[model samples]
Target: MTQALSQTRTGGPALPQERRLVTDIPGPRSTELLARKKAAVADGVGTTLPVFVEAAGGGVIVDADGNSLIDLGSGIAVVSVGNAAPGVVRAVTEQVAAFTHTCFMVTPYAGYVEVCEALAELTPGDHAKKSALFNSGAEAVENAVKIARVATGRDAVGVFDHAYHGRTNLTMAMTAKNMPYKNGFGPFASEIYRAPMSYPFRDGLSGEEAAARAIDHLDKQVGVANLACIAIEPILGEGGFIEPAPGFLPALAAWAKDNGVLFIADEIQSGFCRTGAWFAVDDEGVIPDLVTTAKGIAGGLPLAGVTGRAEIMDSVHVGGLGGTYGGNPVACAAALGSIAEMKEHRLDARALEIGTLIRGRLEKLAAEHAVIADIRGRGAMQAIELCAPGTKDPDAARAAAVSAYCHKSGVVTLTCGTWGNVFRFLPPLVISDALLEEAFDVVAEAFAATA
Candidate 1:
C-alpha cells in the first residue's frame, strides 16, 4: 500500500498539490512569452525552464497556461518555506505598508538588528557574533572576503575544485566552472587560488588524504602567511550537491585555524534547514570564522548576510559595509518571518524526513538503473550522478535527457555538476511525501526511458 503524506502547510495562495499539464510542456502562452523574452531580455540571462509562472505555493508552481507542476528545485533553493508562505506574505505585506527602505546606513531599523540577532542565534556558534546584510550571495561573498582580508591582513584567497561562488569578477575567480560562469570574463581579481576538493566518488581518497592534498596545494601555491581565507561550500551546489568526504572539512578547518587563516563557509545554497540543519557545517560541528548566506535567507526576498565572530565582523571601518538596499526593511521582516516559520514548524526535522524518502526512492531507482553512478547529499539537498554503466565516466547526455523527460512530464527538475552529469533535487521542505514519491516515480520513468 502507498503511504499517505500530510498536505503542504503554506497558508496563503493555496495551490493544489498535484501535477497537471493542460497544454504541452511549454504551452502556447509560454511560447508567446518566450518570444517576448527573447526580444526584451538580454540573451545572456538564461533560464532553466521557459514556462512562465503565474502563481506558486505549497508544493507546486502554476504556469501561465494553467499547468500545475511539482516544484523540485525550489527556485534554486530560494523558497524553501514555500512560495507565498503565510508568515512571509503577512510580514512582507505589513512591512511594505509601514515602510519600504530607509537605507539602514543613513537611518537604522529594528528589523536589521533583529535579523542579526537571529543569525547569531541560529548559525553554528555560541560565541559573540555580528552580521552585515547585503543584497545577493555574490555581494555577501565579496564582502566576506573583504572582512577576512582586513581581519587577517592577508591578500590571497583559497577556494576548492568544482566550486560555484558567484558571477562577480572576484567570485568568478573563486568559482571553478569555466564555461558559463567565466568564459569571457577575463583577468579576474588577482590573488585567488584554487585547490583540489574532497570528491570521494571521483578521487577515491580518504577524507584526511583529500584534506592533505588541498593543504599541500595551498601551502605550495599560496603560503599560509599570504592567505586571508579558505572559502568553500560545505555541500557543493551547482558543482552537483557534492558533499565533501567525512573528515575533509574538519581537517581543513583545523589547518586554517592553526595557520591564522579564516575559514569561510559559503552556505548560500545549503543553509536554512534545507540540509536538515540550520547550517550544513553543523553536521561536522565545524564552526567557521565567517558564513555567507542567501537564497533561502529571506523566503524569496532579496537579502543576504555575512555572519561571523564579532571581532572579525567589527574589524572593518564603520563606513566600509553599508549598501543602499542592504538589509531592506521589507526583506528583514520576511527573513524574521521565515525564521519563525522554520522554528515553529521545525522544518529542519521535516528536511530529514524529506531526505529519507528521497534517498530511499533514489536508491531504488539506482538499483534498477546502471547509469546512476552515485546518490549522495544531506536532507532535501540530494543528487544522483549519471555516468557510464560500469565506470564513473560522466554522461552529461544522459543527465540532459533525464532532465528533459522530467520537464516534458511536468516535473521541474534541475541538472548540475562540473561535468554536467548530475540530476539534483532541492524540493521545498514543506513538500508532501506523496508529492515527493510521485516526483520520484517520474524520475524513475525518465531514467528507464533514457536507458
Candidate 2:
C-alpha cells in the first residue's frame, strides 16, 4: 500500500485488500457453525449467505472458515463509521465497563441524555428539536407516526410505494413491498395507505409527473386533509436507493404543509453524512416535522431516534415515547464517539469522494453492459439496477448472480429494490480509497465474467 493511504486514519483506498477463498464458501468450520445455527437460531432470522464470520475490523470481515471478505455492504449501511472503529470501540468498552443498561426511562443516565442532546444538535433543521430514542429503526418510525397522529389528531398515515419502513406490525403496514417483508405476516396496522414513489429508472416519469401523479391520487382517493403524516425515506433504502426527483420531495413537503399534514423523513439508511449531508432531506432544504434515524446513528450498535419540532414532540405525554434499552449507555457512548468521528474526519466530504469514484466506475460498466440499465444514488449510498435490455422488467437473476460472484471473489455486496434488480453499495464512509477501488475492481470483474 502507498505510504499516504497506509497512514491515513479514515476510509479510502488506504485500507488492506481482502483475501479470497480457496475452498467452498461454507468450508468445514462454517458448515459446522451453520448446522449449530440451524438448531439454535430462529427461522425468522434470515441471512443473505451462509458465510460464518469470526471477526470483522476496518473494512474487512474475516469468516470463521478462513476467508477475509471486503465489506462493501457495511452491515446493510449500519456501520458507516467502519467495523470496530477505534472511537466506537473505545467508547463502547468504557461504557460497558461502567454499566450496560439502566433503563433510560426508569433511572436515566448521562449517556442517553448526552446522545439525545447530540441528536438535537446534529440532525437537520435549525428549529428547536427534541429526541426520543428506540431500540430499532422500525420502532423510531412507528413512534414518529404515532406522535404525528396524536399531534395532528388525524388517523390517516401516508407512505410511498417501494418504501421499506420496518417489519413491525405498524411498519409492515407502512412498508410498500409485500412479498418477503409482509408476506404471510398479516393483520397489519390500519390507517396506512401507499402513494406512488418517484422512481426515475424504471418508471420513466419526471419528478413533476411523479409528484403530480401521487398528488392527484391523494387528492382524489384519500384526500390529504385526513392524513396525519406523510413518511418517506429521503433516499429510499430497500425500495432501492431511489432518490426523489428534483421537484418531487419539495413538492410533497409543500403539499403536506398545505393540507395540514406532517412530513416525516425516515433517514434510517441515508442519514448521518452517508448521503454527503446530515440527512438526505436537507438536500432540498426542506424541513421535516419528524426525522427518523437508526443504522449508522450509533455506528454498529442498535440505537434509533426520532428528532422533530420541539412543540410536536412535547405534545406527546410523558411516558408516551421511550424504551428500556432504547438508548443504552453502550449505544449512547458509541453514538457520541461516532458523531465525533464523523465531524473530525469530515465523513461528509468522504462520502462525496466515494460517490464520485463509484459513479464513474459504474457508469463505465453500464456503458459496456446491456443488462446494466441505470446507475442512481447519492453520496456513498449508491446502486445499479439490472434489466432485460430494451425492457423495463427486472433482471433479479442477473443481480443475484452478480452478488454471488462478488461474494466468491471476496467482496460483499447487497441487493435491494421492490423488484429485486438493484445492487446497492453501502461501504463505510471510513473505507480507504485503495480498498474501495479494489472492491470496485472485483465488482467490475464480476460483471464482466457474468457478461
Candidate 3:
C-alpha cells in the first residue's frame, strides 16, 4: 500500500524476466492512473491489482512504476505462449497491415476457416468434427447450448455445481456462483439445472459415486428427454481449479451418450495446454460431444469456438448462428500464430513439467501451512484451497491476505472458487525455473508473514 510520486516511462530497463520492484506497490504513476480510471471507468468494472502494466513478456509484467512482477496469473489463463510471442506478433502485425476486419459473417475470410480447421484437428476425438468461431468463451458456451438444443430439440441444460460458464445472461443462469455473477441480475434464462460436482476434498465420494449421484439427480429432476446438453469444465476453472475425480468426466460423458444429451466440455480456462494436455478431459479419455474453447486459444486476442460432431454443429440453420464481430480476422490470425507456438515448442509437455514443479512446491508449502485445506488442479493451472486450521470452513480472509502480500511483494497472484478461498496459480508456460522458484519463494514468505 506504499506509494510515491509516479514514475514516467522513459523507456527504462530492457524489460528483464526477473521480478524487480523499483517503486512501492501501485507507485505514483499507477496511483495517478488509478485515479483517472476511478473517475472515468464504471464502478462495476473492478481491477485485481491496480498497478498499470506498461509491458509484459515471458513470465513477468513491467508496470508503469518500472516494477517487474512475476506473473503467476497469465492474464487469467490467456497468453500461455507468453505475451507478445513472436508468432502471435508476426501474425497480428501481418493481418493488421493486410486488413483489419470485413466482418466474418459478411465477407468471410480464410483466417476464420483456418482457425476452425485447427480446432477440428486439435480438439478431442477423430470423429468428423466442425467448428463455429466466436468472440469469447461465453459466446462459445452459449452457442454450444444453441447447437445442442437445435440438434436435440430439447430445452433443458444441465450444469454442475461450482461451475463458471460466463457472465452473459444465459450463461449467468448456467453459472452456479451468485454474488458477483448473478446476485441481483437474475430473472435469468430458464431450464438450467445444477448437479453436484465430484469434489474429492469436500465430498469425499468416489468418482463413480459422485457421477452416479449427479446423473441420478439430473435424471430425476430434469428428465433425459428434455435435456439438450450437460455443460461442464473438465478441470473446473473459476470454481478453484477443481479437477473432478478421475472417473467423473468419463462417467458424465457416458451418461450423456446414453441419454442422447450433448456433453459439452467448457475448456475455456483449461484448454490450450493449460492443463498439461490439449484438453483436461483428455486425461480420462472423455471425448465430449461438443467442446467450447477460448482464453488461451488466440494468444491474447479475443477468439473462441465450439467444435463438435459435424451433424450437431451443422444442424442449426446457417443464418441462426454468428455475430457481427464473432471471428475477427486479426483474432483468427493470432490463433494461427499461437497454435504454431504451441506446436513448435511442444507446450503440452511443458505444461506437464510445470504441473510437476508447481505441485511439488505447493505440497511443501501445504506441509508447513495448516490453512491449506486442499492442493488441487493440474499442469500450470494449479490452486490451493484455504480453510480454517483443522476445519473445512473456508478462510477467504487468509487467502485474500496472502494474495495481497504477494501483490505488495511484486508477485502477481490470483484467488478463485465459489468461496473465494482458493489461491490459484497460472504462470505462463514459458516461465523459467529460476523465476518460478523465486515466485514460490515469495509465496512462502507471504505464508510465513501472514501466519
Candidate 4:
C-alpha cells in the first residue's frame, strides 16, 4: 500500500484532515437552508436528505452547519475522482478563464477533439471507433439510438425491464420504473420494446436461461429484424447493481450481430473506472456497437458521449447528432483532466480496493442480518438488497429507515432498485480508508437500529 493509503487506514492523521464534524448532522444552518431552498427551489427536485453542503473535499461533505459527513454516494457516482479533485479543479478553473463555451460545432476547439480521442482510446474493444459528445447521458443514449437506426434502417429499439436510461420522453419509455420517472410523463417515444432482465436476486435465472427467455420474447413479440438497437446497461444501474450472469452479455451481443441489431451499452453509471475497469463491458470482453457514457465523464460536469464502431457512428448526417452545448470546451477540458486524473491516480485500482473493503463489511453484516437478502456488485459500485428475511418481498421500509438513520448518524448513502430495496454505495474512488471505515460504521449502526 502507498504511504497515503497507509495514513488513511490509520485513524490518527486521516481523521483530522478528512473528517471533522463540529455540529449535529443537518444542524441549525442546514435546517434554515433547507427551509430557504424549499421556498426557492422547485418541488420537483426532491432531496433524500435535507442537509445543505457548504463544501466538499476528499471523501467528505462539509455541511452549512460545520458538520462533516462521509459521502458514500458521491453525488450519485458523478464524482468518482472525488469532490474538488486538484486536477479537475485546475482544469475547470483554467478552462473557464480561457472561455466557457463557443459552441464546438460553430466554433471548433481543441479540447473537444482531445476529449473524444481520450474516450476512443480508453473505452473497451480494439475496433476502430468514432465518438460524438452530448450534454447528458440521456442525450447520448437518445443519439445512440438514432445512430443505430440510421445505420441499420430499423425502427424498433429493444430495452430490458428494470433498465434506467434517463428522464427524457424517449429514455423514460426506455426506463422500467414508473413512479417519479415515467408515471405522468407519457406518451413517450414509440417503437421501444422491453424484455425481462436477468435479476438473480428476484428472477433466479441463469445466464443461458435469461438469454433464452429474452430471445424467445423478442422472437415471438418484436421480431428481431425490426429492431435497430438493443440497449442494455452492462451492469443494471437502478435495477439493483446486478451484474448480468457471466455469459449473458456476450451471448446477447452475438445474437444482436446475427440478427442485424446494434448492441448499445448504456454505461453511464458503470463506466469511467467506477467498476474497476475502463468500462463494465470489459468483464466479458463484450464489444458493444455503441456505448453511452456520462456521470463521471467530466468529474461532475454535465458532459456525456456515445462512442462506437466508426461505420455506425458515421451513418448520421453532420447536422443530425449535436446540440449547442454538446461538447462545450470547458466541459471537454474537465473531461480530459478527469481522464488524466483517473490514469495518474489509478482510480480503477482504488475502486477495487474500496469494493474489497465494502464487500467484506457488508457480507459480515448480511451474515448477521436476516433482512439483508443479498450483497452484490463489482468494484466500488456495490449494493445490499434488503428483503423480508427469507421472503423475496422487498423490505423498502427497512431500506428507507436505514437511509434515514445513516443520514442522522453522519453518513450519506443512496437507494435504487424497482422496489427501492437496494442500498447502493458509490463512494468516490479517492475516498480515504478511514472515512470509508467510518461510513461503514455508520451503516452498521443504521442497520442495527432498523433491524
Ranking by TM-score: 1, 3, 4, 2
Which one wins on lDDT?
Answer: 1
Candidate 4 versus truth, CA RMSD in Å, comes to: 2.4
- What is residue 368's positional error in candidate 1, in angstroms? 0.8
| TM-score of candidate 2 on Cα atoms, chains taken together | 0.96
Q: Give the winner by TM-score: 2 or 3.
A: 3
lDDT of 3 by residue, 217-323 (tens): 99999998899999999988888889888888888888889889999999999999998899888889999999999999998999999999999999999799999
Candidate 1 vs 4: which has more lDDT: 1
Q: How far off is residue 445 in model 2, in Å?
A: 1.8
Specify the poorest-scoring 10-residue window by lDDT in model 2.
1-10
Clashing pairs in 4: none
For model 1, residues 257-282, the per-residue Cα lDDT tens digits are: 99999999999999999999999999
Candidate 1 vs 3: which has more lDDT: 1
Q: Considering lDDT, where higher is better, how would the candidates rank from best to worst? A: 1, 3, 4, 2
**TM-score, prediction 4:** 0.96
lDDT scores in order: 0.93, 0.86, 0.90, 0.87
- Which RMSD values do the candidates have, in order? 1.6, 2.2, 4.4, 2.4
Candidate 1 global CA lDDT score? 0.93
lDDT of 1 at 17: 78
